[model samples]
Each structure stands twice: as structure tokens, then as C-alpha cells.
Target chain A: MAGTDHDKPLITGGPAIILVEPQLGENIGMVARAMANFGLSELRLINPRDGWPSEKARAAASKADHVIDGAVVFDTLEEAVADLNFIYATTARERDGFKPVRGPEEASRRLRTRNDAGERTGILFGRERFGLSNEEVAMADEIVTFPVNPAFASLNIAQAVLLMSYEWMKSGFGAEQTPFAGPDVMPASKEHLNGMIGHLESALDARGYFRPAAKKPKMLDNLRAVLTRPAFTLEEIKLLRGIISSLDYFSPKTPRGSGNPERKAKVDRDRHGKSGETVKDEER
Target chain B: MAGTDHDKPLITGGPAIILVEPQLGENIGMVARAMANFGLSELRLINPRDGWPSEKARAAASKADHVIDGAVVFDTLEEAVADLNFIYATTARERDGFKPVRGPEEASRRLRTRNDAGERTGILFGRERFGLSNEEVAMADEIVTFPVNPAFASLNIAQAVLLMSYEWMKSGFGAEQTPFAGPDVMPASKEHLNGMIGHLESALDARGYFRPAAKKPKMLDNLRAVLTRPAFTLEEIKLLRGIISSLDYFSPKTPRGSGNPERKAKVDRDRHGKSGETVKDEER
Candidate 1:
């Protein structure tokens, strides 16, 4: 059911969808459908087969043309993702590299949460014929893979994206929690989320998630959105902050400890330029 | 041939066999029969109708008596798994509970990995007629469900155990390395896995995947295993990383438009767990 505030956007910020050399129009259409299923609209096609906005794809989109109609076509992968702040790649197979990998739900959660903080997030999907080149992966901040039987882990592009988007929609759309009825049974207040953002920022800052100084402004805005996106009841927010404080302040001292270094700082700096920066210049 | 090197255990770990109040000794016999076909040997009984360790059961176990002879019996599931590290409950319906769940293959990987970590792992299969109770499911750390179409997700107790056990045997028993050459490629490495994990974490972190800190740690771990289970080749991992990075990192942002904080961060926490979780819980 549409909430009392039906006019509000389901997603907090922009997330571009990049399909690197997709093998089929059906898959593109399916991906579009999945995006639409989760309220995603913008799609970037990087050398897709069967052309852009094909009838086949439109048919697959069903009611998802809102995504298809606005899809941007690009000849190169770099051009497709030039302006995004954070990017995640989805794959059924594991990619060998020295980076972080997560599940689609995890990736979607991170993307939605970060974007709620006000940064742009994008999800990358690969072609059916083969997948993305190694160079393309180096450009991404993270990877998203489905938990499947490794022997049978092959998932259609749309399914992969849809699952991720579904996760995003669940949390990003402020739908992550059950509909919290206030004292009078009304929805919770929106301002509380601002406080949640502040808490998150404090935790992140303590962990040094922010860079030296340049990314501070953009990062703070994003942090605010990410925190404020959820309509948290006092109790829920309490629980949220409780876990954060626990992890941030009372973290277990394992031999391998965690410190949130500004991992995305390198990628965030490039957000300023009107055009995008390609970290892995070598094409696969 | 078994890997003679000391690097691997001769018998990694068999799938956890769960007998949810199985009714007949003959069924247990056949269950063991099925398990042997897939090289599975672990056995567990919840509450047998005819009583466990019956001569009838011993007869059914046949040559699989090693499995039946050593089968574990429990008056209550909590007692059965008190010493185990991870427990997965199976089901088929869309019930009220269950959160983060996986299909059989993913469950197998979780079981194998936990086994590798020197933890006791087990699978739970419900009774012949009624399956597991909801309260019983509350005991498990995770839930496993089949990928059959919703209308026909149901499987017999023995069948369900067989499928899950088969996957475990595949993983723990050297992954059928020779019988299925699988394109003549090696699996992904810890280093390669780290990159994909990092990438996924950042993307999801930005998107707010790890909200409500208490659930985030477990959620992220679930996400990690899903992606990491597959044995990825170096080139393949790089390729996948490239493809996903392109979609997630690439693409231009749409112009900002009217949006509301009310709709952002819609907290429907129930969605945190996969439907499969409930299905396993309810059906089993």
C-alpha cells in the first residue's frame, strides 16, 4: 500500500544502472523490469545487443517502460558511469581481485543507505555472452553476488539486478521497517532521522570513514540523506544507534580488527568534475 | 582420487541430515539409501514415530549403518544442536517468521565452511505429515528452502534431505573435481575474494545496507558467503568485478526532482530476511 505520503520518492538519490555488453535484449528488458520493480528509473546501456529500447525489451519491461524510456545508451563503459559517487558490480561468479565483495542485498543496502546520506549510487551488470572486462571491475568500489549453488549460480541479469534493487527498495524507500504507528497510531516523525544521521556521522567520522578534507561536504550531505531516509520510531532509532555504538565503541578485539578508513575517498574526489574519471584506464 | 596432501580433510563434512519426526523405519532406510547415492553419511532424528535405533531402522540403513549406527537422536532440537555452531531449518510455506535464508546449494556452502572452521553443522527436515513447528524453527540460525516454483516447492522429507546432502557431499567431498571438469579452471582465492567483498561492502554501505547496526554484522556475513561460495577463477573474478563495477560505478545521474524524506528509509524490517527463511521454517 502507498503510505500516507504517496507523493514522496521511493528512492532517496540517483543510481545509474550500467550493463556492460549485455548479450540479449530480453535480459536488458528484464533488468529494466527489475529496476522498475524496485522504483529505479535511470538505466545506462553499454553496448547492448538487439539495440536500445527494442520492442522485445519493451515487451519484457511490461509496465517497466518508465525505466526503458529513460535509459541512456553508451558506446563505452566509462561513459555510462561517469557521474556516480558509488558503484557496485553484480555477478553470479566470483571475480578475482583485491577488493571487497558482498551479496546483492548487502550491496543494495549499502547503496540505499549511502545515497540516503545523499551520494549517487549505481549498480553494474554484465553481458550474457561473457561478462565485464577485468579493467572495468577495477573501477568499482564493490561487487555484489547472489548466494547460489556455485555449480548452478548462473542468474539472469534482470534477476540479479531485481534482487539487489529489491533490497534497495526495502531499505532505501523507507520501507525497511514495519509501518510504525506513533502514539496516536500516526507515522513517526521525519526529524528523528536527522538525529540518526548525526549519530551515524559521528560513528563514521570516529572510524575515519571521511577523507582528509575535500570529500567532507559531499560526504556529510550523503550521510544526512542516508540517515534521514528512514522514518525511525524512537525505539527503532535507539536500537540503530545502540548497535552502531556497540560496534563502533565496543567492538571485539579480534586479532584482525576493523577501522573504517576512507576507502571511497579516491572515488569521491572524482565526483567534482562534470565528466567521469576512469581509474582502470586499460581496457580488457 | 582423494587429495593425498595434508591440505584437506579426507571427509570434509557430510550434509546435516534432519529427520523431523519421521514416521517410519523404512523411510529412514530409504533416506540413508538416498544419502549414500550422493556420498552423504551424516544423520539426525528429531522425534521418530516408530522410535529411533529400531532394528527396523538398522535394517533400512543397510550398508549405510555407519550413518544409521552413529545417527544422533534428540528429545528436543535445542538439545540436538546445543553443541553445534550453525543450524538450518527447512520448510516450504510462506510463514510468519524467518529472515535471512538461502537455497540448498548456499546452505551446503555455509555448512561446509562452518565444518571447515571446526564447528558442528546440521540440517533439519520435518516430519512425514506435519513438518517442523514454528517454535522449533526459532532455534535455527538460518533457513534453507528449495528453488522450486512456489506452487510446488514441497518435497518429501527424504527427498529434501537428499538434495541438501548431495550439495554438501559435492562441496565437502572435493567438489566432484574430476567427475565434472567444469571448464578446467581453479576456484577463487582469499585475496581475490577480499576485493569483491570490499567492493560490495562499500556499495552497500553507501546504499545503507547495514542499517540498524545489530542486524548488519550478520546480514553482511550472509551476503559475503553468498558471493564467496563460488570457486572463482582469477580471470573470471576480474571479469565479473569489471562487469559489476561498470554497472554500479558508471552512468550519469538524473536531474534532482521533488522528493520527500517521509518516503525515504521506509523501514519494513520484515523484509530483512528472505522468503526462503520462512518457507523452510514453516514447511519443515
Candidate 2:
């Protein structure tokens, strides 16, 4: 976990997010949460309906207080875009006039290029109901519309923010930053897993866990499924083998009841604790 | 918007999401919202703390009611995942047992391949406080963990679902389904964009909007920046050319004050309505 902390971000500066007359405090807070998830920091509000610093907004922001706390409030859209070198307005409705509309991906790429050239960029999210006015859309450098379900193209403000934020982060930082286990720990080979499976099967068979002969193959497959699915490391294989050895050591040497049915049942109970069949078999 | 409807989807089939012992209704609703955004439909709840049919969960889901409506509830994790052919358990903590671990990307790829081959797949999200247990993880085919800020690796359940759901959609759909304009509507070439920029800059220049002469170059660059940033279609370029022609048509042949200043301000107000300065300047 030491080196892993390198990727975790308290906040990142990329593009400003300007919400134009957002309606709900909860949505505002949720937008902040989504931004934090993808390493975006700047949040600017253009005349929020509920006004600034709503307790509801702060509460809904979850752990993304950094974003909410640092939010910038603007009196109007013009003031919002005044400082930004580039601006994109998000709207679902089509404008009557000529506007170059792009999906989130293309918009994100454009943002990356402008940011790389040391320019401030921002995206505008319109009011919840009507979206950006035609005049507001005209003021922006570009329009970004989602390829969403037509019957249900209406996206929650937070959802829209999340999609764009995700695209921006993925484009900039490459989404495949997941950490991999080092070479010091090797994955157990198929041969080793098979050996353990065979050992466990033999022990179970000795105790008649497979039952009435006809179900043996299916039962064997289920056992194999349980064993094969896990990606066992060398240490894990050794640990499982040790568990199997312990079970094998306590196996009945002679007849089922003659030696000790009690110990056999105990091992069965341990192996198939959830099945509830071991307890029933003991009573029978 | 007619041809645009072709890409819209009401729902899409993908991997299921199984929540094991999830505590809050709000979290469940949020999970549904995230799932719906990525087109994942199946949802199975395992022993929710507040039980089933939680109104709080429904309210929190926002417009993702379809997901909540179709959610299947079960008594235990085993029952929840009984129908899934492939399962990945998500957790942050390191496991002591033998289990194959994969990043969300790899895990999503596996899900896509399995799904394409006509097999059911699902991902397990454990409780919020302590993630999936070693025993629970052992039941999975692979372990999936986000490369989070190790210091704050505790992603809320909804956030975790959003990440995995996003990866699943990206893996299967190629992340570039942005609707490019059809052959009838080609993308405007760089030459065309440059022409439009030059036309707009000249128009603004003639109107004395560049101001005081010293800021001419920066204003020209800003005009070009606004004109060139958007991905314009052929129709959009032609329409913008028409707009420029209209502006040129109404250009004052004589001095600024000699022409009707009132009419000039109206056009400027229509063009840069949000700026407020246009209206203010006319008043002065």
C-alpha cells in the first residue's frame, strides 16, 4: 500500500465545472462527490436556485467536502466564462441555430489539448429542467450532448457530471492504473491445483461424502468448481494442502462407525458446514 | 434528433450486481442509478439490513426506478449469485487465502467475454465498513480491487458500482460510440473552420469590438479559439456562414452614431446577450 498511495489524489486541477442555475442542493453535493471520484477539483456555481452554502448540499457531498468547500459562486454565466480559456455547454435539447455539438469523448480530448497548452477550460451544466438557454449555448465555445436513451435522455445533473468527469480522467491519466502483485509471489500452476483437488476429493470419497454413486460425477464437478475458480498463490496452495493433510490424518482407518463415526462426522461438518446434510446423516 | 435516436437505448444486458449485506437504502438507490447509467440491468440484493421494498432506496435511486423495480432479493450471498456463471468479488483488503486477483479492467473484460459466449456473470460488492470476507472472496472466481488512494481506499458502495459498471460498458462497447455526422453531413474541414474564424474575426474587428487597438491580436486569437474548438458538421458551417452574411448585411455603411444606435445595440444584445455589457454600453 506504500507505493499505491501515489495514484490517490486529494484534488486535481484540470477544468472548471460551472453549474448554471442548478436546482437542488443534493444534486450539487452529488456532483462534488462524482468529481472527487475522478480527481477533479474546481467547482463553480452560476446562480444556484437554493443559494450558496446550503447545509443540504454540504451534507450530500459525502466525503467530497474539499470540492464543496472550495466551490466558487458566480452571479451570471458571462462572469463564469470570463476567466475560462475554453468553455463547453452541456444540453440535451437541440438549438434552432448552428452550434457544433460533440459527445463527451471528443469534448474531453479537446479539454486535454487545451489544458496541455496551459489554458483554463470549463464545462457548463444547465438548469435541471430546461438545460442551457439558446443564448447561453451560443456563448460557449462548444456544445456537448450525451448519446443517451432518447426516451429517457434526461440525465440527473450528478450523472451527467460523472460521465464527463470519467471521460476526462480516463483520457488524461489512462484508466488502467490498477496495481498488480509483484513477481515475488507467483500464481500456483494448474498441476499444483489439480494435486490439491485430487487430495481433497480422495479424503471426501473415503468418508462417503459423494453419496449414492449416481451423483458422484456432478458432486466431483462442483468440488472442482470450488477449487479451480480461485487464483491460488504458492502459499495458498500450501495452506490448503496443510488443511487437507489434517483432514486426511483424522480419517477413519477401519469401518465407518467401528473406528469413530463421531470424528468422521466432525470432519464432514467442517468441510460442508453450510450443507446441513452432515447433521442429518448423523441422526440417521 | 431523428437519426440521433438510432443510438439511444432503453436498456442493455450486462453483468449483474450483487450487494451482500448492504446497510443503507440510499446506497442501494445510488447503486441502481450508477448501474442504469452504464446499461447494466440485473440487480440482486443479499440480506439488506433494512430488508426489501425500502422506500428510501427507491427515492435515492432517482430515475433509475426500472432497476429498483426489477431488483431481486435473497436471504444470502450464495442464493444471490446462484444463477451467475462467473463471479468476481470486489474488496480492498488483502486476502490471506489463495484467490486470483484482477483489476477492474481485466475483470470487466472477463465478464464481457463470458457474456458474449452466452454465460451469466456478476460482481459482488460487500458491506460498506469491512469489505468482502476471506470466505466470501474464496467463493468467487476472481478478486477485483480498484487502484484507489490507499489512504482513502474506502469507496462507498455506489462509487464502487459506478467504477465496475463503467469498465464493463467501456470494455464491451469500445468507448467510442460517439455519433459522428453521417455522409450527408460531413465534418467541417480545417480549411472551412479557418475561413469561418477569419470571417468572424473580421466582423468583430470592423465593429470596433476588439477595442483600443492594443488588444486586437489577443481578441483575434480569442475569436479564433471560439470558432475552432467545436466539431462542426457541414450543415453547421453553412448555417454559421449564413449568420455571418446576415451580420454583414446589416453592417453600418456610415459612421457608428449616424446609423441608428438603438438598432445596433439590439443586434449586439441578441448576439452577446449574457455579457450584459452590450446592454449597459447602449444605455450609456
Candidate 3:
């Protein structure tokens, strides 16, 4: 699912999703999940091939039981869309006659507008194998077709539903309102990040990890890039620093090994007058 | 899938999708299908639970055989995302530390900008049961989490990937750029529409459908609304006109034979001022 349940009710009067003769239970469950991801609750099935109340669908739906529980089953497309003031039929192939077609994004906006204006709206999806018949499509006010690969325009039932549901959610929330993560954790300051990087650098240096000092700068930059990329928190930095400390202590050769003459001479050669002996013992 | 195979090269250097410890082949296949929907090709797997080259995954992928065929498997998350310049880990729960969390939309834009600048990028999704570990997420440049329900923040692996892939495709091609339909069919002209409406209206009038004269205008308006809503093609208009003609000819009380002459005369009186008694016979 795209969004959490409590992420502010972004959608108001969102369109109902009607699946016509959907075959597989997995697809139905996935459709329910996709709907819930986008804050869509209404699920209308027009004579689902596998029948209603399927265990496979429930299991596949994962946690979107709300959508499946409230799902309305209809005998025909006409019955399915009887209450909707506006309807959009999804189809991959162009039908026999001219119908105004809309892509998912545009259709989503229209749904929002019409829904906001107090008109009931719903999107109709066809069967998995054959799609909506011409007569079934005739009942729809607009045709919605994905700008898909012409060579392979077949979209499974759930994928089509997912695209539409995603667009609907995006239209309601405008992407900005969708949070990346909750504010329970705060980002570690730059100084803390720098300190952790220094800790790792020294640990690696002690192990002769930065050999061939000529290419050390680029290697250091790469390491820094990798370390700083995740934007570690204070706690993560502390954990990483602990890991660095463990590595330094567990290594076959430590800086303290230089207390012996022969090892100290080898360490001096490895250091090579670069950043060899700059180990800062700082605690965070 | 959102797009067909020949939707032109709309995306260049799209990001790789890495799944870590995926449990089911069905999930991997769905991820491939979702990726193919948005024109993504590169797929990297990190120690899948069901193993590689899964027959179930291939079956689930449907037409995304290309993505499945090219999937790369890695033993660890470190190796999977190593070659990529940037990586975002998808996780539902708040991990140990703070990281820059981005929604799919923003992340997708960054990915496009980086890819356009010749930087390789990829996204990491954790396992089904438990998401990426702290150590695994620590390797990512950023964290990406769906704005899912707090009570049940579980989005199946494929749905998460689908949202990200959809955002990626949408960022590359603005919603406006997505076509509604191909340009082969044109909306029927007003004259053709009017002709079809008139045909249906006269057929209904002959059947005494508008017997309540006061409501005729509203009924006619509603009829026109239904007719025009679909933006019918010329051929559709012709087909509809044919249907009207068939109904008129097959009506039990066609103008040619009045079941009750008095009632028929009254119907004639109601339809008197309007399209009185004209019918055109044509063959396509």
C-alpha cells in the first residue's frame, strides 16, 4: 500500500473502484491492498469469477480487510455502475467507436473535482482475459487507457487498479503531504557525522586499509560518500562508532602493536608520512 | 503494466530495484511486473528466500520476462547496492537513527536528475516479514517509506516497489505528456451527434416514452448528456442510429400500426410539434 491509514484523510468522496469479472483471488486481494494504499475504501465487484469471500483474497490483501469487507458485489456492469453519476472504463485496446479517453492522472483530477462537487464517481476495470465488452464500455461516460507499450499493452487486473489508485492518492495529497518518515527520530548533526567518519577512517588506517597513498583521497571520498549517504542519526553514529571500535580492537594489528620496535618500524613505513599517526580519541 | 513494450525510450538509465531476502517467488515476479510497468529493467536480488530462477516468479511476472531474465542476485545487501551511486532503502518502521526520508515522488525526481547526470542509482526493498535491518539500511543513501496506514503499515513487497516505480515513470514523463488515446479516432461532429440524438428521440417519441409532456425537456437533456458524455466517434453515432432504427422498426406500435388508434393519436399529438413523422432509411 502507498500510504498509512492515519495519514490524514486526504481523499473526500473518492471514486469507487469496480472490477468487472475479475478472475484471480490474488488479483482481488492485491486490488484491495492497492485501494487501501491510496485511501480508497469502496470495492465493487461485478460477478467475480472466483466468487466472493475468498480466503486467498483475504490473505493476499494482507491488511486491507476494510476494503474487502465493505466490497459490494453486483451481477452486471449496469448494476455495478447504476448509482455512480460518472464512470470511467479502463481499457488497453481502442474500442470500435470514438470515446474521449483519459490517462490516469487526468482522470484522477477529474474524479477529485467531480467527487468534490458532490457527484458520485467510479472507475470500471475489465476482466483479466478479455477486458470490457463494447456494450459494457458503452455505459461508461469516458474511457481511461494507460499509455502503455503498444506491443504489450496487457496490464494485469491489480496493476491497472494500482496505477489508478496511486494517481487518485497523489491527486488528493499532492505528494508533498505524503511523509517520508515520522518525526520520531532526528537527523544527526554534521559534526557528529564528521566525528563518526573520523573514527572509521582511523580504524581503517590502523589496518593499512588506505594503501597506495596516491589514490587515498578518492578512496576516502568514496568512503565518506558511503558513510554520509544514509544521514545517520546520533544513535546510529554511536552504534557505527562502536562497530569501528570493535573492528579496531579485533584487528590482527592495532596502533598499540607499534609499542614493539619491529612492528613500529613496519607501521612507520606503511604510514609513509601521510595521515598515518593522526588518531583522535573522541567520545560522543 | 502501465506501459506497453513499444512506448519509445521514455526512460534512460533508470534505477535498479533491489529486493533483500524476499520470501516468495510471487513477490519477485510482481516486482518485475511493476518494474516493467514503469519502464525499469535492472533487477537485483539479495539472497531470496525461495532461491533464484523461480518458476512461480516467472509465472507471476506475466509479460515482464525481460526483467526476470536479466535479474542479478547478490549474496548481501552490500554487494547488491555497491555499484550504484545512490541507493534508497524502503522500510516501514522507524529505524534506530534519523535519516533523510523521502516519498517516492521526490526520490524519483532525484533519481532522474542523478541518472541524467550519468550517475547510477537503485532502490532497496526489505523482506516480507521484517524489513531491512539497521545495518542493511545503514548502507543506503536515504530511506524511503510509503505513507501507509499506521495501524497496519504493511505493504506487500510488490506494492511498495510499484509505488516507487510509478513515481519514477511519472517524474520522467509529466502527467500531461501521457496520452489519453491514440489519434486514429476523432470525436463525432456536433451535426452527427445531433442526428443520432434526433434519431433516438424520434424513436422514443414514437414509442410514447415522453408521454408526460412537462418532463420531456429534462428527459431530453438527460438523454443528450448521456449521449455526449462518451464523445462518441462517427462510427459509434452510426451504430447508435442503427440501434434506434431497429427499435423503431421492431416496436409493436410503430406509426405504421397503432394498437389503440386513440392512444396513438394522442401520442401523435404529443410528438406533433417536434420531429413529427420523418425517418431516414440508410445502409452502411
Whole-model alpha-carbon lDDT for candidate 2: 0.66
Compare candidates 2 and 3 on lDDT and give the better one. Answer: 3
lDDT of each: 0.54, 0.66, 0.67
Tens digits of per-residue lDDT for model 1, B194-248:
6655654543443344655577677666655545544555555554443223223
Residue-wise C-alpha lDDT for candidate 3, range B121-155, written one tens digit per residue: 99988888877788989998888876653444557
Which consecutive 10 residues in model 2 chain B have the weakest lDDT in total? Answer: B275-284
Model 1 chain B poorest ten-residue lDDT run? B275-284
Candidate 2 C-alpha lDDT tens digits along B40-123: 878899889998999999997767788999999988665676556567878776654334567776677867776776666789
Ranking by lDDT: 3, 2, 1
Error of 3 at A282 (Å): 88
Ranking by TM-score: 3, 2, 1
Best-fitting candidate, measured by TM-score?
3
Candidate 3 chain B: 10-residue stretch with minimal lDDT: B248-257
Error of 2 at A42 (Å): 1.0
* TM-score of chain A as modeled in candidate 2: 0.69
After superposition, the stretches of candidate 3 with alpha carbons farther than 4 Å from their true spots are: A1-13, A151-154, A174-284, B1-13, B94-98, B149-152, B174-284
Q: What is the TM-score of chain A alone in each candidate?
A: 0.57, 0.69, 0.58
Candidate 1 predicts chain B with a TM-score of: 0.55
